[model samples]
Target: MNEQTVTRDERAGEEAADPNRLLPDEDPSSHDPDDARHWLEVYDELLDFKRKMLTIAEEALDGMRDKPARREVVDTDRRVLRAECDRFEKRLAFWRNRLAAARDGKGP
Candidate 1:
């Protein structure tokens, strides 16, 4: 198969694996507005929590600045926080897109 076909198959497999995956052609009218609102609120709260966690991670790294011996541990912590932040960002984007799609009467 060509690259595009392979990629499409892979994406399909991924969607199959992820129960929460939203299809582009899915009927948005079937979804409840109230549920969407609640999910938006929940996602907002999670994003806020992620921001707070990132702040705490930064503070922890700042505290470790004076202790050279623990630099490796701090670095590892920073990496973990960076990954967590990345995931949070992706999730936020997903929710924002989903909301927009719902508002536009399109699938997310």
Candidate 2:
């Protein structure tokens, strides 16, 4: 499956598994303070995970470059990791904005 398809499938599974999954347009004010805090914590964890993945991918790419036989594998892995990082970055941005709006009393 393509990256977009995989991302959608993953999101669907996550939402199914955790009904509290946050969406981009979620109104943070609708949730209690504790719930909003929990969501922020989750976002932090996911962001950290993506950062670590990006680091590992970069390291692997660097190491694999020395082994000509693994060029394709390295490239594929890098692409996947980068895509995951990008996805997480976008999610984090959305959550941050939502949190800010809620804090500013501009959220619904």
Candidates in order, TM-scores: namely: 0.53, 0.57
**What lDDT tens digits, residue by residue, belong to model 2 across residues 1-108?**
899999998886555344345556556455344455666677678768867876876666666655864676565555555555565566566666766777787755
The segments of candidate 2 whose C-alpha lies over 4 angstroms from its true place after superposition are 1-36, 66-69
**Poorly placed runs, candidate 1 (over 4 Å):** 1-32, 66-69
Query: Quick one: best lDDT, which candidate?
Result: 2
Candidate 1 to native Cα RMSD, angstroms: 10.2
Give the winner by TM-score: 2
In model 1, where is the ten-residue run with the lowest total lDDT?
19-28
Candidate 1, residues 1-108, lDDT tens digits: the string is 899999998886455345354435433344555555655566567658767876886777766766864586466555555555565456556656667777788863
| C-alpha lDDT (0 to 100) for residue 83 of candidate 2 | 58
Error of 2 at 48 (Å): 1.4
Evaluate residue 22 in candidate 2 and report its C-alpha lDDT on the 0 to 100 scale: 52
